[model samples]
Target: MAEDSGAEKTEQPTPKKLQDAAEKGQIARSKDLGTAFVLIGSAAALLVFGKMLAMAVLTIGQRMLRLDEKDIFETNSMFTAWGDAGGELIMPLIGIFSLILIAAFLGNTLLGGFNLSWQAAGPKASKMDPLKGLKRMFGLQALVELGKSFLKVAVVVGVAFFLLKLFFMDIMALSLMSEPNNIESALYFLGWLFLGLCASTSLIAIVDAPYQKWNHVRQLKMSLQEIKDEHKNSEGSPEIKARIRRTQMQMSMKRMMQQVPTADVIVTNPTHYAVALKYDQGKFRAPVVVAKGVDDIAMHIRKIANGHKIPVIESPALARSIYYTTKLDHPIPEQLFAAVAQVLAYVFQLRLYRKGKGSRPKNLAKELPIPDEFKH
Candidate 1:
């Protein structure tokens, strides 16, 4: 089992493994996916409400730049007016952010479903380990992440620069245009550039979400021995199961011993196997094995039968057939009926002779007429 600890994780995770992992907040979600969603969602929210926000900003700018010397010189008036300007902007900003927050939640849920991970939120001492933190943040793996961050930044920035360069003539024309026309042209180009950046960033999420899911599964993959151990845990541990089996067998043997006294006869291999049987003409149509065993147990059954004055007959083949094939308290198998009947009739003859009601019958059958199918 210890060796199996090093075994390859060659098996797919079982459903129980996935469920357990999910419960602990170990779900696959791409950071890029959420980032892209928030960016794109924020851009859309802005486009829809840009005019309202622009009006608030323009109002604040007008108040700040008013040509009234009295307003500029009055500190209390200036502060009060600025505060009112801020209030106008804050509400629209909050609305935009609330929309972005909803978008982020939806994106995360779409990727991995909802998982409230108490464990992820709970404080952990390992997080404070400077050595571990340093290794994670600035180690070899960190370089890979840092390189990716640089690449992402460069790609978005490069595309935006290229778009700006492509519209160089429009940018230059802005200087000669009216102020309102200049602002509109600038906004039109900037909006398209930002949307393009978000679209490109989203491509990263397309690959990352699936990769995260596959990696999460790889981390949870199980080895053969791990599967066995899990099965054992689900059913029961080996030692407890073995002890339970022994306890059950002991109880069964005790019950069988109790039934020995009720048996009319016990057939034996004489030394190795024993099968005690009982039959009542009105109670049962066929003989039932009341108790049975082999080796030491067989000898024990024989001793009990002897103590109860139950007859014991040595019939190795018949004893084996009944012991192996018949369940306690169940009728001997039908194929074994003739063999058992011969033993019972012989037992009955002995009883009659013992009671002094008749003379001894002929010698018992040399062997029970065992059917080939019933042979051990």
Candidate 2:
């Protein structure tokens, strides 16, 4: 007969799996918007500062050097003019260098703060596959890239055309005017164009920012099959899982054995099962099962009890009841109270016998507390 496969596989993320993937640095990162904002603002400041510095230097040089009509207008003396221009250029170069430094600092700070890593960047089979490369070039990511390019082109063209038409209308109006204030009209038109361009570009940026982020996140999503494959690879194969399970069982047995010495009594099924119960009258109204197991664990429990001089009572039904129903460190249920009481009485009698006193049952007559719902 063919081996039976388990239930139909469905991809679901567990907390452990998510934690493992995060620890392995499988998440994506992007350039921080704050960094871009800082860079752009710094660049604008640098441009203004550069132009101001250039104007100041040029003014100082022209006043100080007093280059006459001979040097200013002579093409042959251009070399002399070039030599003079170099001094004026120094401030602009300084401004540009400062902008670069500021932008680099901002970008580095943003990236450092985010602490991003991509697991896919590590050596991986999929990254090396030709098929994966082809899929990336022709996939949803390609479509998103195409859409982005089209939108950018459309926005730029539309804004440019609108500004050009406005500029043309202002020029036509100025030409029709009886008193053509050429300088005033020109300055007003330039101001309007600058403001319009800034507004239009800002609108595009506002819309594109969120759209670009969504596209990036969508591209990072793993398929159901890919997630399953990753899980299998990271978590180990079925045989390895079985081996891990056996190791865990052994560890659990060891822990259970350690708890046996602390137990007040060992309830047993003679040879098959054992459950250790601990009770502190001030701390607990009823006994708590500390450890319980079957087969080799049961024998281990009995051996530990003997070593500790703790009484072991054989009660097959009580052993099974406590083993199945009570978890480690939980009080036994009221349903098994009567049965457990009898066992405790026998244990107390055994202790009395060992002390060379008349073996008598202490008050086993105390009734177990009835549940609230069962009371009148």
Best lDDT goes to which candidate? 1
Model 1 residue runs over 4 Å out of place are 1-23, 38-118, 128-135, 140-142, 163-194, 206-252, 280-285, 345-369
For model 2, residues 1-376, the per-residue Cα lDDT tens digits are 1232332334445545545555556333233334344445454544456445546455655655776788677786767656657666776667766765765565444421333446634777877799989999999868866776686567667876888886787777776654224534554565455545544544545555566555534534455665666778877989999999999988987787888998989988779999999877899889998888889888988998999999887766667778877888899988777777777767768788778896655543333333343322
Backbone N/Cα/C clashes per model? 0, 0
lDDT of 1 by residue, 165-252 (tens): 8888887887898745555566666656666777777877787788778888888999988888888988999899999999998898
- Predicted structure with the largest TM-score when compared to the true one: 1
TM-score of 2: 0.48
What TM-score goes with each of the models?
0.59, 0.48
lDDT of model 2 at residue 221? 49
lDDT of each: 0.83, 0.66
- Please state the error at residue 148 of candidate 1 in Å: 3.3
